[model samples]
Target: MNNEEKYKKNIHHIHDKSYKDLYSKREVALDLFKNISNANWSKDLKAEDLTLVNNTYITADYEEREADIVYKANINNSEVVFYILLEFQSSVDYTMPLRLLFYMCEIIKEYAVNAKHKKYDKNVKIPAIVPIVLYNGEQVWDVPNQFRKMIYNEELFGNNILNFEYDIFDISNDEKLNKDALIDLKNVTAAIFLLDQKMDAIEFLERIKVIALYFNSLSDAEIKAIKKWIKNTVVDPLAESAIKILEADKREVELMVARNAFILDEMRENAKKEGREEGIEEGRKEGRKEGRKEGIEKSKLEVVRNSINNGLNDDIICKIANVSLDLVKKIRQECEKN
Candidate 1:
């Protein structure tokens, strides 16, 4: 696989594991919710009351896409569902609002089906849904956050149109995160997002230290899991090697030496690969051009032979077939000999 595809796969794996293992916990999920929603709703919520629901939703066509997390919680004495969409793509998806809308619809539809089987009241209302997008992409998300904002003639529809806006926690821009106030798990999550961005091995090691400090409360297994995740997802060979080495014990100087060596090796390999690909592409283009030119020349020769058989003179055949007089005379001699 190409480097970009490998990076994307690693990101997906890390996101899947982190959200399932850590963020699915009530305390961690609640902290993340509070940070994204900017609401003081945690005091009212008991950890036991928050339930993590299955986030895999199938569309009408039976195609499935897994959401990061879906939490069922009681907020303001009413049932509310939080749909957390973890976006780890390098580029911003402009259709995110529509995509979230479809997911919400599917969730509501499933809830309705279950309610029917339970024989709930016909007048029962659907729970409020809070769509949250946690994006750690390289590019800033510039798309509109609301479903209605995506419509071209949204203003013309006025109040009759349906619209919902999702909350976004853009981790690419550090301004969005309150680094000081975040809990340990949330801080670790932020550190993971920051690690996704481009950074040298030394810088990565420093970030790892910050994550390790916050990870002190967790079990050794948990720390090991995070380290393994770092090793897998990091694109830089030096960074990956450093994580593997640093996991056993924090050795900064050794990590730096490994990183420097990795950088030189990586540069050489990348240059060689790019040169080979360019050369191959150029060769293919030239081959196709030559083949086409030869085919056209062959076709002209056949036309010249046919003209000679049709009793056309050499001068006329040369003009008609767009060939030189000497070439037409050579063809005439070959035809006469045959």
Candidate 2:
């Protein structure tokens, strides 16, 4: 795929309300801490300090902002708070550190504004403010996809040792994690990395299906919705895997989905949720809202074209896109017209 098409595939979440509950849930921090490397998260504030209260806040800031998920966690202890700010970049961000620095400084000024720093040394009494960059783009991350140089470099050459100030996790390419870690993390980890990398959609889908089957009891239409997203994402590279599992037991998936009445409950709840968000946001941004609806449809067609290229089953693409189930029946008509 070209750069433009690939960009949309990896980073469309900022515009999609379909993910409202995923990041907003209190469990997101836990999942990211568990799956992402070198992250040790605690619900108990396991530090040598305060009681923990998990919190979240998000903003469109679409008009002008550097983050999609802007939040603060109240890690209470000794009247000292750990202030954190977060940003999720589906594409390479050249100005990320500067943006993070800007936000971090605001937290400091905020501390001073509240008179919380009174009678305390401005140099010592301030709480720690952390800014994190969760990079999920497809580049090496040494530089932005558009630019080719480091923005600034303050050389600290002392005793023949060099110290670079930037700290980043260039988790692109195949080094993200092994299949064992993916399976151990179950669905959430699978979703995070699968979406991050240009992994085969079919393989991820089949894995998600099995995970869905295990928790087939746990996944509601949400898994099905995620499947729809997986299908919308790309051609089913693991189509054979899904078919092998399905053909092995015709009634297995049917029974599993049925046993979990949770899907139906979720469907109803989702309908209400979708209506509320769509009504408010969609009404305000009709052009973008309709553009997305149309874009997903077109992206689905692109995936079908990829399936035909890969020699996979083209029968399910339309059904999976969920734009119109009737599109499946009309595939021959659509395919032949061109």
lDDT agreement with native, every candidate:
0.59, 0.46
Where does model 2 exceed 4 Å of error? 1-21, 34-37, 40-66, 76-80, 119-124, 143-153, 156-174, 213-251, 254-338
Question: What is the per-residue lDDT of model 2 for residues 1-338, given as tens digits with 9 covering 90 to 100?
Answer: 85444534443554232233344443443445444534432344432332222332332443223333434444454454665454555557666655555555666776677755556565656666555555555565664321112343333433344222333544454355545555555656455454444443344444544554553332444344444444443343443334334334545754533433243334334544554555556546677667556545555555554444443332344433343434543553466467
Clashing pairs in 2: 202-237, 202-238, 215-218
* Cα lDDT of model 1 by residue, 97-119, tens digit: 88778778878887888767444
**CA RMSD per model (angstroms):** 18.5, 14.9
Candidate 1, residue 288: CA error in Å? 38
Give candidate 1 regions above 4 Å deviation. Answer: 1-22, 25-27, 35-37, 58-67, 75-88, 117-123, 178-186, 213-225, 235-338
lDDT of 2 at 77: 48
The lDDT leader among the candidates is 1
Q: Could you estimate the TM-score for every candidate?
A: 0.58, 0.51
